[model samples]
Target: MSLPMTCRRSSPRLLSLCLAIAGALAAQSAIAADSSAATETSDDAAHPPASDTRHAEHAEKSKRAVDLDTVVVTASPLRTTAGDLGKPAAVLAGERLDEDRASSLGETVSSIPGVQSSNFGPGVGRPIIRGLDGPRVSVLSDGLSTEDVSTVSQDHSPAIEPFLADQIEVLKGPSTLLYGSGAIGGVVNVVDGRIPEEAIENGFGGRAEARFFGGDQDGTTDMARIDGGTDRFALHADAVYRNAKDYDTPDGVQANSFIDTKSGAVGGSLLGDWGFVGLSASRFEDGYGNPGEPGDLSAGERGVHLQLRQNRYDLKGGLKDLWGEGNGLRFSFGHTDYDHIEFEGDEPGTTFTKNANEGRVEATFGNRDAWQGAVGVQGTDSTFAAVGEESFVPQTTTRGYGAFGIARRSWGDFQLDFGARVDKVKSEPDAMASRDFTPLSLSLSGGWKLGENWRLTANLDHAERAPVEEELFANGPHIATLAYEVGDPNLDKEAANQLELGLQYKSSLVDAKVSAYYNRFKDFIYLVDTGDQWYWDEENDYLPIRQWSQSNAIFRGFEGEATFHLADNDSGRWDLRAFGDTVRATLADGGGNVPRIPPSRLGAQLRWENGDWRASLGATRVNRQDKVATNETPTAGYTMIDAHAARHFDTGNVGWELFVDGTNLTNQVGRVHTSFLKDDVELPGRSFDVGVRVFF
Candidate 1:
């Protein structure tokens, strides 16, 4: 494959480092194999059997006052634990996930450090990692891309449902090596377990939940999931429905802020001692109003809304002991058909559609005592089209092919990880010259144990990304942003070099982690105001002109979180947690601050758990953002308070949980700096959600 122009012309050191790491890993693999075979007996006595080691680890974990860091991160190819990863990672599951679930994926995971949400309204929110959003972030479901048009517009919402997820994994910083070149900023993977990889433990199991929201946002949601299997086969099914009315704000009700959505899926798998194969079919439908452009009711004007639908199919298979006892091979494929319609009241305006397919195959091998690694190849093909008066981007077809390798090794108290990926992307716009780009990514991470309870970690990454179709071909009006948009067909690939340092501490009474990162970018792509306007006779007005532009930039940030186990006695167990994050992005060459960057935030939470009862109270303070880019306005910050409580009970053969969650308890008027509608709309205020869950 050809290398990226930037890499070929200016970044020889990055390419050399990647090659050197690959060569060293290849040699280490050979040495590891020989060493493993020669020292099998001696290593057994030193490390104990696998089962024994697991039991001991489990016993040690049980003694910990807090188990938040013990969860395994399924997003990793090697299935590394969150606490053991050399890079920054977070996982939300079990009761914590249940309490944090929201109408949108971004809202669900916004509480994590270094992560925030970009909001158009209550019905639309997408995850923004550090100071980056849009195409820079990749949203996945069960390791496969969601294949949604959310990246095309700031107002669109992700197609995936957060409530259905079994676990949510967030990887911060450059994760292009494991995902794709598009994920130069970060990755968020939602694990729903829609396709069972193993048989149900008791042959049959399921869960059902119903929830209601009161106060500002009046909504109702219901969902159900079932899993069943025989000794050789497994089956799974799930469905969800949600509806909400206009949400209230501190001043008044936010007009046209309503949502309606429904989704369902069915899957089945065949299991055997040698391997397992699974297939799944799913469908999603959503309809939500756009609060930013809520037309004037007194003038008899209708509001704008969006209706979206998608049908998807997935196939996955795995084989054990492919080449040796600890080796395995796995493959996954997904096909998606998506349709979205923008409506002016009851009349359809812009229609968007996409047909996409993606697939990947991976092989994993190595002994735990010496080294472990995975090698994989991935490919994707998609066609996107926009038709209507409001359409801004032309029809286009995009294809990508990639290969990657990752490995990890440990010696005594130090662990090291290295990975490399190369991708070729081709974008073809109708009646336009096709553009091709070869993006390469590389990463190296290491962790050193400073003591029994302290660890230090560092990471270095070099990543490159090809511009998306909209960035290359868009040339019309965009109603969402109220601007006349333009794209450049000759833009070059975007590249970044980043470095991160982290410190972590873990003990029976306390757990803490802190990280600092800096990223330098070449030819960073962003939208710029050209001080021009396009007169529109249809609207009897003029719209600002915004064009896709490129420049050199830098991003720097720090994030930290700490948890303290206060007490554990017959009365109950109490814990307190604190977290804070800050990020700044600026254009190089004195181009000033980047627009729409999230501001600094500090928060704390206190929790109590006793037997079947649990509760928490938290508050967050967001600092005002005054470092605005050219012609950009500043944003005022606010403080938010939230509380959650849940109780578990058993009835016959079924288990039940009742939960109540309250957000924005102070009814504060808050605005998201990253939102395009921040000046026109405020966040929902003072809402309480009550729910019940049933498990059998």
Candidate 2:
């Protein structure tokens, strides 16, 4: 029998490796900006564009200087704010993303306060917010959920295309009321307008972008996209190819990032003054799998190859301004084709297929109001199958439907919200007992303003989750996690309720936010090891030779974030800033700590910028933790530090930026307290990635 081992994932090897490459890449892309009035100055050279003299003579006589203001509007709030939503949120420009050379969405966002990541391999990782993941957090695009298995399992990858999005939104609260139920943790929304500006006038506009990751995987992302619109109709399309080699760990630990992913998407819309009609189709295909770390082989030495192809189409429309004005309406129907199969050899041979379709309709009563409300309904149908000469599980089908409502109000100095939902899920498979689940969820919140810069916010949330068919009925080796997971068809739904309180403070130069929460669970759904590995067969396949049940659990935590504007010069030349976060969570009973929960951590940065030139230095400390859950791995404490610089250039109306990012500067090798297998599977040490961005 092959024994399982945990691979410590917090090592700073790959993190520091990237730092060594930054200087070389920076020198390779050295290009300076001009300072001729309209010209932008680079860090290497500075002379303030000569004050745009075109208006200088008259402007100087009047002694009037140019001033700029920023407005930030997000789905989380009822209205737009002055870059401060009063809740804990972070806004990162796509340009700043370039300077980081981040390969995965989690890696990019991990730089933010109170965020971490779950790494399956070099090619795949998911964001961990406040020590919570999976269905606890919802990831969406254009207000619609991405129908991928990432929400179901850690090994599965998300299907949405990140490179195509215009901006990313991170909502760290139960504000997911509108998106769906079971979002008691938080929400992540990736925004892609999918509209063409030129199409409105000339009927067309297109963009192309490419970035390369030259670390251990030697990976590359090449993409091209185009969109156009007419008086009443418009179209948008995108195509991308991503490929990478096996990655190398710190101390040259051998690993694999060898994966190939190809995806394409097309969408269209009909426009009008009151509302717009839209449609879109997308497909994602990839061949990838996770490998064992050294002796870690619960699933075995050779992992299953992946042949996954997912396709989806959506028909949607929203009233830009309707319901007599100041109101909006959204109607949508969506269909999906999901297929995933595990291969026989070094490459995929056999497979499994799942097909699904969903539809939803919702309406918003007001965009900005002291009182606002909305209601929506959604439904889904999904079927599953297995492939090859040796068939395993029989055909299975699952269906679900739900109705949801949300309302908000602000009176005096208090802002309050209430939301509720009811859902039903049913599933059937060959030779297995049928099952049905009815889940109810609700959330309520209230906030008070202590003063112009101080606020107190509180919320209570109740949610439930039904176990998936596979988790409830599986009888053989799934190969994803290398475990022969057995399912209990008689399992019960997991129900939870949580109470939270928060404090926020905003000032011209200082910002601070803190939150405390306590969550209780009834029949909480969790995975347990049978301690026996078996190769289950048909006649003996009621389960993977193991049994499962439910348990009661509780989770509580506190998180804090702070941001300081160290300095900002009136010359529009220089601005400096620093920020960081800390978090801690306590679990219930002898069930031990929650699995894959992030530990207490802190990060700080020093950034300076004047005009087109920018520079930064940062440090992060993740405390060492030995307190772990059953089957969970332990990681040592570690600290990391780094620095970088970049410059922007402009010619005519087009502009470009070249930058190099350094990571894991201090070369710390620390492990995480949140991983199930953190001991054997380690995080990549120091590494480097270089890239460029252009605006037209």
Residues 1-696 of candidate 1 have per-residue lDDT tens digits of: 232232244334334433333343344344434432211121110112122222222223122222546666767877777899999999886667788899999999999999999998877889999989999999999888999999999888899999888778999998999888879999999988777766554455566677788999898887877666654777888888889999999999899899998999999988776667899999999999899888877788878999999999999887777777657888899999999999998799999999999999888889678889999999999999999987799999999999999999999999999999999999999999999999999999999999899999999999999999889989999989888999999999999999999999999999999999999999999998888999989989998999999999999999999989999998788989999999999999999988889999999999988877889999999999999888788999999999998877654434567889999999999999888888999998999998767555
What 10-residue stretch in candidate 1 is worst by lDDT? 38-47
lDDT of 2 by residue, 1-696 (tens): 111111122124322323322332232233112111211212100111111211221122222212111223334424334233434455443444444424456666776666777666644566677666776677666556666666545656666666665556666655434554435456666555553211232343333444455453366665555544454666787776777666555656545345788888888777655456777888888766554423223555554456678888878766644564556666667677777765544545545566777777776675344667777787778777766632334567878888888777778788777888888888888888888888788888777999999888887888777766656776665444556666778888877787878887788777777777777878765666666767445435432333455778776667666667666675333334344454444345566665556766677767666666677777777776666666556677777777777666554332344656666654455444554335545555665555454332
Best by TM-score: 1
Task: Count clashing residue pairs per candidate.
Answer: 0, 43
The Cα RMSD of model 1 versus the native structure comes to: 13.3
Relative to the true structure, candidate 2 reaches a TM of 0.80
Tell me how far the alpha carbon of residue 34 in candidate 1 is from the true structure, in angstroms, after superposition: 49
